[model samples]
Target: MDWEYFFELLLGGLTRGSIYALIALGYTMVYGIIELINFAHGEIYMIGAFTALIAANVLTMLGMNELAVLVLASVVAILYSAAYGFTVEKIAYKPLRQAPRLSPLISAIGMSIFLQNYVLLAQTSDFLPFPSLIPELEFMEPIAHIISSAEVIIILTTAVVMILLTLLIKYTRIGKAMRATAQDRSMAMLVGVNVNRVISTTFVIGSALAAVGGVLIASHIGMINFYIGFIAGIKAFTAAVLGGIGSIPGAVLGGMVLGWTESFATGYVSSDYEDVFAFALLVIILIFRPAGILGRSTTQKV
Candidate 1:
């Protein structure tokens, strides 16, 4: 544990935190609106990364430059994931909204399994290498260090996206509709808010964010398997819980906390036990402050 090691780990943690935060937003937004956990969200993330990878490879095969291919891939991945998310909501969850709550949860889980198997079948189950859009760079300051250009891009990209999302949700007309729907669906419908449209929009936005996260992480890590989403989803869900499930800002804070916790734990303890520390912290947080750090507790009317 030297200063350089500390800074490097911190930087890595922050980048990872950003990805987790993005994915957590998808979870929190859906939960806020319907109180159902979308287990397929992780699979959606996995597909996003793969979609980007496939797009980039196809562009390269068609003789496009790497930079251009990267741009196209990112755009395609986001759009594809957003559309897929919207469809999932319309076809899978929308019809079940009025049914028993457990129905949607089961459907989500089934979708998750289906996605995992589908990907495994379509593209070999073995881990595939992700394309690197950004070159590696070294910090030439007092502490010379190596950092990927992707890391810088991931952090900045995610930060800008988060800020834009905040603005969208806080100031835009659709944002108000989203809030109204989240508050009370029946009242929102009475007030002229199209509940279906709002829900669809929410899914599209959240899924697109997750897609961006998936692309960034895939580029940074360089390899991904179909099962990657399982752990990542759990961690993102933990982040949502840690930040107060329905609060957008809380997800960001929770993601950073969870990322830093794992980073420090691995640095001080053992990498083998990194996962244990993460869940342990989650349990501790839940036990002491179930509402989360920035979350306001609410009571349900019986």
Candidate 2:
């Protein structure tokens, strides 16, 4: 294998990893704050892509340039997705909070299917092409030939958002409430944290991040379908599990690792086997460290 080819593959892997990291953050945050699986989170991602697509089209009709359209579309898509997420939590999850865990899980799955079919019914089952907002520019020198605009945008955008999230979780008052709730819901409530508000806020933030991921991935690939989230969701969930479901930083690490693994598998092995490789890695990791890379084992008191 040529060294240059290897470097290219690595770069591609990093770019894909960044996308996975963003999506995984959503999964990790929701899972951390509430033990629910939120199976519909992936469907939220799919909706976000469509939302961006519609927003971009509207912007285009309004005569906005590519850059402006991208910005508008992103803002609109994120807001819509966040609203949808908050609503889903309120309607589908909140009421089930005190109910059986299986009930919530089932509702999540139902929501996922409903969103998918809703999209399919509204839009044809055919894959619709999403207009490219970002130019596909190469930034590196001839010999290096290292980067693509998509990769740069994905890395820089995700880095900025991650930094902001870190700050928000560390410094903000609501962030404190969220952390407190995550630590002990009943205790946090006793301490005056509005558990409902915190949960809704968590869902909003996660959904917004997933919306960003949806836009990025759709822009990168240039086409989308209702089912796009299914595989990505599984991979992201795997990343969250790999890194430690409740750990934010762990999700980032897990996403990057999963992305690179898929890239290498596609480059060296077969693209067809990429999905298989991801699950295999997950299985291997579980076999060695059941709790996950950053997950801690806790003792139960009887």
For this target, which candidate reaches the highest lDDT against the unseen true structure?
2
lDDT of 2 at 9: 87
State model 1's lDDT: 0.87
For each of the candidates, the C-alpha root-mean-square deviation to the true structure, in angstroms, is 1.9, 1.8
CA lDDT for candidate 2: 0.88
Poorest 10 consecutive residues by lDDT, candidate 1: 138-147
lDDT of 1 by residue, 39-97 (tens): 88988899899999999889989998877887889899999999988998888899998
Pairs with steric clashes in candidate 2: none
Q: Residue by residue across 1-302, what tens digits does model 2's lDDT show?
A: 59988988888888888888888889889888888888888989999999999999989999998889988899999999999999999989998998987999999999888888999999868899998777665444343357767668888888888788878998999999988998889999998999999999999999999999999889988999989988788888888999888778888888888888999999999999998998899889889988778876656657
Cα lDDT, all candidates = 0.87, 0.88
Cα deviation at 258, candidate 1, in Å, is 0.7
Look at candidate 1 and give me any clashing residue pairs.
none
**On a 0 to 1 TM-score scale, where does candidate 2 land against the true structure?**
0.94
Measure candidate 2: CA RMSD: 1.8
